[model samples]
Target chain A: MNKRELFAQIQEKKSFLCVGLDPVMENIPKHLLKYEDPILEFNKQLIDATKDLCVAYKPNTAFYESMGWKGWRTLTETWKYIPENIFTIADAKRGDIGNTSAMYAETFFNREKSEMGFDAVTVAPYMGEDSVGPFLNYKDKWVILLALTSNSGHKDFQVLETGGQKLYETVINTSSGWATADQLMYVVGATRAEEFKQVRKLAPDHFLLVPGVGAQGGSLADVCEYGLNDSCGLLVNSSRGIIYAGKGEDFAERAREEALKLQQEMEQILLSAELI
Target chain B: MNKRELFAQIQEKKSFLCVGLDPVMENIPKHLLKYEDPILEFNKQLIDATKDLCVAYKPNTAFYESMGWKGWRTLTETWKYIPENIFTIADAKRGDIGNTSAMYAETFFNREKSEMGFDAVTVAPYMGEDSVGPFLNYKDKWVILLALTSNSGHKDFQVLETGGQKLYETVINTSSGWATADQLMYVVGATRAEEFKQVRKLAPDHFLLVPGVGAQGGSLADVCEYGLNDSCGLLVNSSRGIIYAGKGEDFAERAREEALKLQQEMEQILLSAELI
Candidate 1:
């Protein structure tokens, strides 16, 4: 999806929320195990319950990959199930050299080859431009480059003072040249709310896929205050808080309740910010 | 494999050559298309031909993942086919948060879970300590961190001066504290030959998985000159230069011939250093 189409979806849905489909078998409801593929069933219900409340669905590939080929098949099926109007992101932090990265691009963006074409794929920026360039080759696809991550390890190297600027700043600054905001987005963790202000200055027009709102203790208000742009350029992702909200037979309804709450809050924010 | 076992393999084979199995279906010999799974056949033949010459096999996951579930199955089968004595590396440059990284660790390290138990998996260092910590939880499994890459984009952010040290240097120094050299390795591209001296200062004992040796224009002699240590702590990888040596029915033989040439060079280097 292009920036305009994504912004349109956010405006139409009244929420910039991106529900994370990181379903672990151990965490899914016990009753759902009766299904042939419990994870796929869980994911389908979650998508069904929350599709109207969110503008995108971000699936962290590790959750599926850990389960082997069966899990990969589930991931492909889940991607196919997501509504076309709502954006999809393969939160697979992949990056390599030019040619190798091209294969990764084909994996996430070429539907004919990979059986699933996500609108965007989160990429690690450590490998630099060439590693990120191949993803940008696909005309409408997005490359959500990791900038300021939410993990405690974020301080280990990202915050280091590099050439009078922090490493994350250098990443945002240097990587801006690789692609425009239309095709590029940054993964700026919501846990680092204060850094959002600094990041907004560097990437005034680019979208930021913000993870760490509920389960990770990041405040939605704080993220919106600093991270939001005229186009509502922030995709706040909530995984455990919504999908695993309840484990009963009414799990999907409970997930909708959780998503509805976030959507309501996002609606208020969007209204106040005049983004809708 | 453990550090001692890896070094023993290197000494026994008299080579530290690592053959990169990055097979593109379009690039493989036309005759191989007769096989039920041509990519798997190609990988098997490549592994068979170079198994004796090289001590390690590094398959960049993108090459297989691009083909979807079938490709993933090929990767699993290929992993099962490799000789147990030789070290296997899932050159999947993966890293995420603590919990997410645990899933990634399971995907590559836990054979029971992912069906592909690799001795080492290359990880991107941008996410910090927690992102890399989970992989170290597995016994005898290695986390080969990306320190300095071979691509032209490496100059973008990796070389940025951070607190008087380059970003890659900071990655090596900070991450060295996360795990012991026995479990941790760094990827120092052969293209940056001069940087080998600087890298060695920070990580003298840690093995460096050096790519860009041949196809990327990195000289093997230059890499070995400043990069090699007492245990010959280097795994020089060659993908296109060796695997795609010939496109005809005799491709496997040609690949062996190419691998033999590199093995011969590595053997001479080991002999001259008196490390064999």
Candidate 2:
């Protein structure tokens, strides 16, 4: 989806929330196991319950890949189930050499070939421009490059000073020149709320797919305080906090309740900021 | 395989050559299309012909993932076809959060789960220690971390000065503390021959998986000059230069011929160093 359309959806839904579909069999409701594919069924109901509450769905590929071929099937089916208007992101964190990266782009962006056409795919920036170039080839699709991650390990290399700027800052500055805000986004973790202000200065207009909220203990108000832009260019993601809210037969409904809380908070924030 | 076993295999084969099985369907011989799975057949033949010459086989995951579920199947079958004595690397270059990275380790290391157990899986080090710790949980399995890549884009962030050391150097120094050399390795590209000496200073004992030889214009002699240690700690990979050496029915034979040339050169280097 284009930036304008995404912002429109956020305003219409009164939320810029992006639900994370990182399902683990052990975490889903017990009653759903009777289905042929419990994960797929769980995802379908979750989407059914919370489709109107969020503007995007991000699926981390590791959760699916760990289950082998069956897991891949589940991922493909889940992609098919999500509503098209909601932006879909393959949070795979994939990057390689130029030619090899082209294949990865085809895997996620070529719907006819892979049967899973995500509107965007998260990419690791370790391999540099060529590794990220292929994903940008799909004109309308987005490449959410890893900048400052939420994990504790983010301190290992991301914060190191490089050429007077921190490593993540160099990543933002160098990568910003590679593509326009419409085609490129950055994965800036919500854990570092203070860094969001610094990041906004570097990438004032680009959308930041903010993870590490809810289950990871990142505050939504602090994130929005510094993260919001004129276009509402922030996709705050909540995975386990929303999806695994309840383990009963009404798990989907319970998930909607959790999503509603976030949506309501986000609506108030948007109103106060006069973004909607 | 453990470090000792890998070195023994190198001595047994009299070569440290690693044949990269990065096959592209469009590049394979036309006659192979008659098979039920041309890519699998091509890989089997390539392994059959070059198995004796090279001590390791690294099938880059991108080449297969681009094909979707069918491609993943081909990768599993191809992994099953390789000789057990020879080292196998799923050159996946994957890493994420601690819990998420564990799934990736299982995806490549746990044969019971993923149906493909490789000796080593290349990992990107951007996420820090937690991202790499899970991969080290499996006994005897290796995590070949990306230290310094060969691509032109390597200069983007890898070589930037950070805390008086380059980003790649910091990665090697910090990661070396996480795991012993016996279980850890680094990807030191052959293209940067001058950097090998510096890399050796930081990681003298850790094995370096060197890519970018023939097709990428890296000289084998230059890489071995400062790269070889007492254990001959290097796995020089040549993909397109060897796999697509010829496009006819004799493709396997031509591939073997190319592999043999590198193996012969490697054998001479090993003999001259008196490490065999």
Candidate 3:
């Protein structure tokens, strides 16, 4: 989705919340195992429960890939199940050299090639320009580059000083020149609330896909404090907190409750910021 | 495979070559289309032809993933077909937060979970410690981290000066502490011949998975000049140059001829270095 279309969805739903459809079979509700594919059923119910309350669905491909080709089949089915208006992100952190990156891009962005075309795909910036440039070739698709990740490992290399700036900062500055806000987004962990301010200085116009808000202990208010822009430039993702909220038969309803709470909070934030 | 076993295989074959099974549907020979699965048949023939000559087989994940789940199935079948003595690498270049990386580890290393067990999987070091830590959890598996890549974009973030050390250098130094050389390896592109000397200084013991030979214009001689360690710490890869060497019914024979040429070159190098 384009920046304007994404912002429009956020305003219409009164939310910029992107529900993470990351399902693990053993962790899913026991009763759902009766289905042909428990993970697919689980994801379908989650989407049905929370689709109205959120603007996007991000599925981390690792969860599906762990299950093998069957899991990949589930991922493609799940992508087909999502509503077209809502943005879909293949949260597969993929990157490579130029020619290889093109194939990776085709996997996530070209339905004719991979039978799964996500609205956006998270990309790793380690290999640099050519690795990221292929995803930008998909006109309306988004490339969410990893920056200031929430994991503890983020400090290992991302925060190291590079030419008087943090490595993540260098990532932003160099990558920003590759594409504009229209087609590019950044994955800034919600846990790095303080760093959000610094990130804003470098990339004010680009939307940030914020993970770690719910299960990873990142505060929504702290993230929204500086992360919100005129475009509601943030997609705060909550995976386990919302999807695995309850394991009972009413799990989908329970998920909606969790999503509704976040949507309500987002609505208030948008109203206060006069963004809606 | 562990370091000793890998070196043993290199000595046994008198070659430290890795065949890259990166197949494109459009690129395979036209006659192979008569098969139920052209790509699988193509890979089977290629493997059968060159199994004795090379020490390892690295099927880049992008080629399979581009075809979607069916492609993933092909990858699983291909992995299962490789000889147990030869090392297998899922050249996925995958990385994510800790938990997510764990899932990726399962996808490539834990065959029970993913139906594909590779000896090593190439990982991107953009996220640092936790991202790479999970893959090391597997007893005999290896994590080949991306260091100096073989593309123009390698100049982007990889060469960025961080605390007076290059980013790729920092990747090696910090990551070396996470796992022993037995479990960890680095991808030093064969194209980056001059950089090999510097890389050797930081990671003298770790094996290097060198891509960008043949088609990418990397010299095996230049790489062996500074890259060869006592354990024969290099697995030079050539994808298009070896696999697509011919486009006719005699494609498999043509591929063998190409692989045989490299195997002979590698044999000479091993003999000269007295590594055999």
Model 3 chain B: lowest-lDDT 10 consecutive positions: B156-165
In candidate 3, position A180 carries an lDDT of 95
What order do candidates take by DockQ, descending?
3, 1, 2
Segments in model 2 whose C-alpha atoms lie over 4 Å from true places: none
- Worst 10-residue lDDT window, candidate 2 chain B: B62-71
Q: Which is the leading candidate under DockQ?
A: 3
TM-score of chain B of each: 0.99, 0.99, 0.99
**Where does candidate 2 chain A have its weakest 10-residue lDDT segment?**
A64-73
- The local lDDT score (0 to 100) that residue A178 gets in candidate 2 is 95
Predicted candidate 1 versus true structure: per-residue lDDT over B103-143, tens digit per residue: 99999989998898999999999999999999999999999
Least lDDT summed over 10 consecutive residues: which range in candidate 1 chain A? Answer: A156-165
Instruction: Kindly provide the TM-score of model 1 when superposed on the true structure, using C-alpha atoms.
Output: 0.99
* Candidate 2 residue-wise lDDT, B1-276, digit = tens: 899999999999999999999998899999999999999999999999999999999999888878887888889999999999999999998999898999899889988988889999999999899999999999999999999998988888889889888889999999999999999999988899999999999999999999999999999999999999999999999999999999999999999999999999999999999998
Could you give candidate 3's per-residue lDDT for residues B1-276 as a string of tens digits? 789999999999999999999999999999989998899999999999999999999999999999999999999999999999989999999999999999999999999999999999999998989999999999989999999999999998999898889999999999999999999999999889999999999999989999999999999999999999999999999889989999999998999999999999999999999998
CA shift of A178, model 3, Å: 0.4
